[model samples]
Target: MTWHGRPSRGPSASVRLDLREPARRARPAVPHLPHLTASAIATWRARMLNEHGSARVFEGLARQFEGAGFEAHLVEEVRGFADEERRHGVLCGAVVEALGGEALTEAPVGEAYPEHADDATPLESALRNMLSICCLSETVAVALIGAERIEMPAGELRDLLTQIYADEVGHSRFGWRMLDALSQRLDDEIKERLGDYLEVAFAHLEEHELAHLPEGSLPPPEGVVYGLCSGPDARGLFFDTVEQVIVPGLERHGIPARRAWMRRHGGAGLS
Candidate 1:
């Protein structure tokens, strides 16, 4: 799937997918529906605008990663992520604008860490920092795209969302592998820090955040793959990664993920 470079200004660009059944078998992260309406749609759109920043965010992260001593390979990986993130900004911005609204171009919904910043950053490199970015971030994105099946208006918008979703899986897998490789050599202190970082990241994801995100179905015109327009359990699906996936993986490494890290300098470091 590819971004058609079209503005998602209507029902056409907004699509949702129902990957709950498949997700349950895979990780048990499913969206439970109640009801949906235009208000719900606006709520989700506003949430995205409030939570996520403009395309500048992706560009910012890319520059920061490159400035850091990250491997060329890792930097390249961030490029891919940046591409997707930039496109998401465009698609989301278009959706909100088309709906006769404005997107937040100044402050972002979530706070961003600077490139040269210390452990005060969410992108702290120690431990599972990369994993949180890749595995956890991408995993939730994939599930979110799936949950869209119920909420998406069913058309071109659905296609764009899915395209973004599919790409996230690979990104998540790559981050997972990177962490897995580092896991063997990492110490218990680093693992503890990773756990703490992941916990913090999870706090940023609330159900209401992505609840109204649109979804779509393929080979449409016949019928939608999921519900016409239903609401999913945004809260449950959002944090599935840390609770169900990443946390367990950390535990297997004997890492204490739930507890807060006591030290200020403990995390992926620059030195």
Candidate 2:
């Protein structure tokens, strides 16, 4: 009844940042906007601060995965993610630095994992962590990406988003696929528990901090969901994948593929 791909185990060796396609480069700064455009500056800086904090949380959670006896590959992915975020922070800060500033060193994520993780049995702790990553954060991530596209029309901003949307689909898929894998081992009792967990997690994403970025932006509102969520082509691809592939895949493992979940969560399986 937990989220998937935040795998507990993976290799411990250092990971190289070699992507078949390189990670997006540090973008050339726009010459106009005279001085630091305060709105864009604050919006981006605030977001990067959150990213650094989320990365820290992921780093800690990765260790917890190791302690729980998951494979080394999970640790390796975690390390890789941590490194990528560090680089993201660096690249993002370059823009700030261009304006004569530096990103704050690193900020801690404001929340704490629940007591169930510390005091409960293995199954319970695992469920807690999974719920935290997959249901809560991953869902929020997708929404934010969609929202950012609508609000920030800057080329650099759009480019950054393209990279995130591509990578994050995989992360979400991992968590969801993991959950489907788990459903195979359980009875209906567990299914109900999982359904409840997903329910609450989705509800959390509905709250204020996550609903969208604070309203103002540079290019004016392009409608609520960037081109991705709000457009036909992207929506078609998202729905086609969910209906044709992800939902079918989950159904194979005895997980219910509620059409509502797909629309709300997107084809959230391993994209």
TM-score of each: 0.58, 0.60
RMSD to the true structure for each prediction, in A, is 11.6, 10.2
What's the lDDT for residue 219 in model 2?
37
Off by over 4 Å in 2: 1-27, 34-36, 99-101, 105-109, 118-120, 146-157, 208-271
Candidate 1 segments exceeding 4 Å error: 1-68, 94-128, 150-154, 206-232, 239-241, 258-271
- Native-referenced Cα lDDT, model 1: 0.46
Task: List clash counts for every candidate, in order.
Answer: 25, 15
Tens digits of per-residue lDDT, candidate 2, 56-126, equal 65676667667667678866776566665555554455444444444443343245644355445555456
**Residue 23 in candidate 2, Cα distance off native in Å:** 15
Candidate 1's TM-score reads 0.58
